[model samples]
Target: MQRILEALGWRQGSFVKPETVAKLIGDIDSTFTISANNLLVVASQSCDVASSQEEYIELSIVRPLSAEAFNKQYSHNRHPRILHIEANSNSSDEKVILELKAHEKIQIKKSLLEEFKPDSSINFLEGNLNQYIDWLAGRYKRPALPTKFDQLIASSDKKGKRKKIAKRANEYLTGIYVDIYPNRDIKDEETYSVNLLGIASNDQSIASATDALNEYADILKDAGMDVSVPKVGTEFKISVGTLRQYQRINFDYLSYEENNPIPPDTGI
Candidate 1:
């Protein structure tokens, strides 16, 4: 005989349908009402969910990707507001896009979850679990950039080249590192220097990656930023009055794959 909780799918990435919510937790309270039409995925650390440490398990709500977001390659991915999980990864039939919003997370009683049928619940890919957890945690962990600096990076959208560049770059690049000049909190009045260090996802992508990166440099130059992108594994100095910033700017639109674990930079 299986242990009560052992038979339950309480691990991170395990998700159940809205109809299952009423069966598991019941309609005695409004949780089911709050969770209508949403796919529920365990959001807490898997170890924490397995332990008898808490009364409730954190779960995030999954919803259909909007038409606009679905069409945009990068908007639905690696974004702070939501995460895009492909349908195939979730056992859905269509090759559609699904969005999981961070703010919409809910906590359900662990006791109720333990009673649900294990086989009925669907799960996201084991490989995607880490990224999902990081994305969830990143909701709070997002870097706080100087308002102007952030706006400056976001300004690339005005050039209308970012989408083309991002689509190309995310397709061919694997990992990224960045260095910022005058390494302190940047002010709005001054121009800053940026260096991008990038890796090609594979041998086949090196040529494509080179092309995309060159265009990326042009995008930065057009923005009045002095930028450099070094070859993979090349070393650079982080001198005085300089700091390395991640999750701030450069290739933020790039999504991840199992082949590459290191995340790329934010939008440039």
Candidate 2:
């Protein structure tokens, strides 16, 4: 279990996709209290059963910490943080069958007995539990953007007030002072925190500013918010301070003044 946890780091992968999130939800939804036998089965199924150990842990102890509430608090996107084996030893059959189904229909027909010579003493592991959780967090963590343009509009009219405009201006200028991070998807929430570093204009109208803002919007869309022009003639300036450690700022393009030095990427 320690090895498994060590292997599953902070990055996303195939097994750690959205279905793992659904499975975590489903597991919590199905049982209010997990039986001791179920916990033992989960533990047994997760690890290779070389031999039985007498000091097997209790389900009550593991279930609560391994439950959805724990996941909601610790694991991003409510992903399962713990993996355990579940063993069922009561089957009377000499052959074990593994089914890979797609929507209740068999996708690729393969029976364990036919595929590999059946050994009644050995148990076949069903799924890669670690990868499933990674995939889940990767999927649900970044939600999709809305289909229509109206959806991007701020619901409150006061959102465009002078105070808010000043705040947004600060946010954009602040972008030049911080280190920015990469975004995995357009709907990512962390992207909103980063500011627009600079802007360029093709024309003088509000529409032109909107177009430039739209370009920056494309850069930040995957991060979180949509782009819109501030009313025409909106210009602001600021003197950059020393960047905070680990804070990031991003720009679509950047130009340095003559004799000015460029910042280094921290690779966080």
Candidate 3:
């Protein structure tokens, strides 16, 4: 649960502000619980509540930002042992949780919620969980860069005294390729290979790809994956003929198999 919570950006002892505001924005549920040892109250609500719900159960609410002043003012006399866990979509188990003393104020600012937007993308994936994950692991297994790179460079200041220099960079996307690998011993090294690759494209597309790729990269790394950037000059290359033949297809029941087999047909 902590791992999943960290994935949502909630660590121990951090106060959640406005309290209910976070849930309203993030689509998360709030509950109350009390500590078994000290009987400390944990409340994840708009303000605070009594121990009538449970003395030993603790509650926590995680959101984009905190509204401490708002909660304190409206809480009346029912403030519990409020602790805000300062984590959002950016947290993985690898990122250690910062310890907080009891009753410490959890800081909230506009920028923090913007930082957690990637988890919103994860939520988007959850909305189409079965379809998207299967498509990624199967039909979309071969990664490619978008064609919008040249626009970013051309629009940038190529002349003048060069206040800023525009340069090309390679964006690498690493994930569990999850396709069948060649292994004679089926029982030992079974189906699927996890491969990492670096893709080069026009500047604009790389920018968006970089953000999306890094989010997944963190998740993969946390899952004990040996992720690496694909070779740029060798493994990947762009040709005029290749671009003419390139087409991004929809991966669905008619396109890919359950196991992501080539030429379709193989189902898991």
Query: Model 1: which ten-residue window has the lowest total lDDT?
Result: 233-242
Question: Each model's RMSD to truth, in Å?
Answer: 8.2, 19.4, 20.5
The candidate 3 region of ten consecutive residues with least summed lDDT is 160-169
lDDT of 1: 0.57
Query: Local distance difference test, per candidate?
Result: 0.57, 0.27, 0.28
Please identify model 3 stretches exceeding 4 Å from their true place: 1-193, 198-201, 222-224, 230-268
RMSD of 1: 8.2
User: Which portions of model 1 miss their true places by more than 4 Å?
Assistant: 1-9, 17-19, 24-37, 64-77, 86-98, 145-148, 151-160, 168-170, 173-177, 186-191, 199-201, 222-224, 230-268
How many collisions per candidate? Answer: 9, 30, 19
Question: Which runs of model 2 end up more than 4 angstroms from their true locations?
Answer: 1-32, 35-40, 44-54, 58-128, 132-179, 182-268
Tell me the deviation in Å of residue 207 in model 1: 2.1
Please write out the lDDT profile of model 3 over residues 119-169, one tens digit for every residue. 221121232323222322332243322212112212342341111111112
Give residue 162's lDDT in candidate 2 (0 to 100).
23
What TM-score would you give candidate 3 relative to the actual structure? 0.20
Candidate 2 lDDT by residue in tens digits, 51-142 = 12312311111222322233211221121223232212235544322111111111111111122221223242344334233322332232
